[model samples]
Target: PFVPLRRITPTELATHGARKNASKIYWTVLEGRVYDITPYLPYHPGGEKELLRVAGKDGTKLFNLTHSWVNWDNMLRGCEVGILVSGNEMPG
Candidate 1:
């Protein structure tokens, strides 16, 4: 399922993916389907050119891998950071 970007927040990142004293990172979705997205970070078409934008963060790698069937390829364009907004829709 696709989640809106608005629902994600820095605190969420800190709690979920952002780690302490780490420059490289990415997120993992523990549910809804086992998937890991860490490998795709360096390959992010967005270019690792600007590490500042994603420094000490988890790229929510699970989102891409878990939802591959969703054709989320295009969604990667708008992301300024890696975030995982997994699980079913948030109770509408």
Candidate 2:
């Protein structure tokens, strides 16, 4: 059974997760939702460009459907980290 992954935000990464490799999880936005695609960073077909688009800001619209549909597997590869909320970052 796969666990549903949690949501995260740029602020969280800026605060702590960006300092290290294992801890450096990045994300992108598709439609109106934010999807954590950090695991796909190394495997991104578009290279670092995709990661840079939303590296330090909200990626609410830069997410490409083609990427999501093509690399959906990478998105589900990791366990749920947590959901980012206003003020709080960890999911409950």
Candidate 3:
């Protein structure tokens, strides 16, 4: 089941990313969607450092470059936090 998620503004996303390595909760944006990748860090096949490199920032480009064929929606289904809503967009 694909449950709808809340939309978050870029400002909010920036705030979360500003925490850097200190944050207990790490959020990364991919294809306009926000995901809590903290738990997946240790389990990441490439190792946590690779994932941590994009922590609190958009990882869409990196993800696509490295694993475009991967089914991210299914892989990250449980980690999804919200959608990255722009200033001009209305959050539902």
Candidate 4:
């Protein structure tokens, strides 16, 4: 099965599952890769609140800040949705 890869822009990424977003589908970016972490909320050791802090935005810095020792790439492989790209990064 081939999963569709998303080229997400910063602006568009900001609305995924933030505080007021109705979708509540918590998407986050880590080292340029986008992940749908909503499904992993219950498994998070820090709890859902900590993940919510990074939801709907680039969480690379925050993720590294607290858990740089953690190998996120492997841990998040299953949750990967796509890559974070600039608005002009993709060509028509």
Best by TM-score: 4
What RMSD value applies to candidate 4?
Answer: 2.0
Which residue ranges in model 2 land beyond 4 Å of their true spot? Answer: 1-10, 16-38, 65-74, 77-79, 88-92
In the predicted model 3, the residue pairs found to clash are: none
How many clashes in each structure? Answer: 2, 0, 0, 0
- RMSD of every candidate to native, in Å, equals 10.9, 5.1, 2.7, 2.0
Clashing pairs in 2: none
Collision count of model 1: 2
**Candidates 1 and 2, the one with greater TM-score:** 2
Runs in model 3 lying further than 4 Å from the true structure: 1-4, 18-21, 88-92
Number of the top candidate by lDDT? 4
Task: Give the alpha carbon lDDT tens digit for every residue of 1-92 in model 4.
Answer: 99578778887788886588888888999989999999989999988999889988889899988889999899889988888888777553
Q: Give the C-alpha miss distance for residue 51 in model 1, angstroms.
A: 8.9
- lDDT tens digits by residue: candidate 2, 1-92: 99675555546544433334455665444433445566667776788665666653445445544354554435544523454445454545
Q: Using lDDT as the measure, what is the rank order of every candidate, best first?
A: 4, 3, 2, 1
Note the Cα lDDT for every prediction shown.
Answer: 0.41, 0.51, 0.80, 0.86
- Candidate 4: worst 10 consecutive residues by lDDT? 83-92
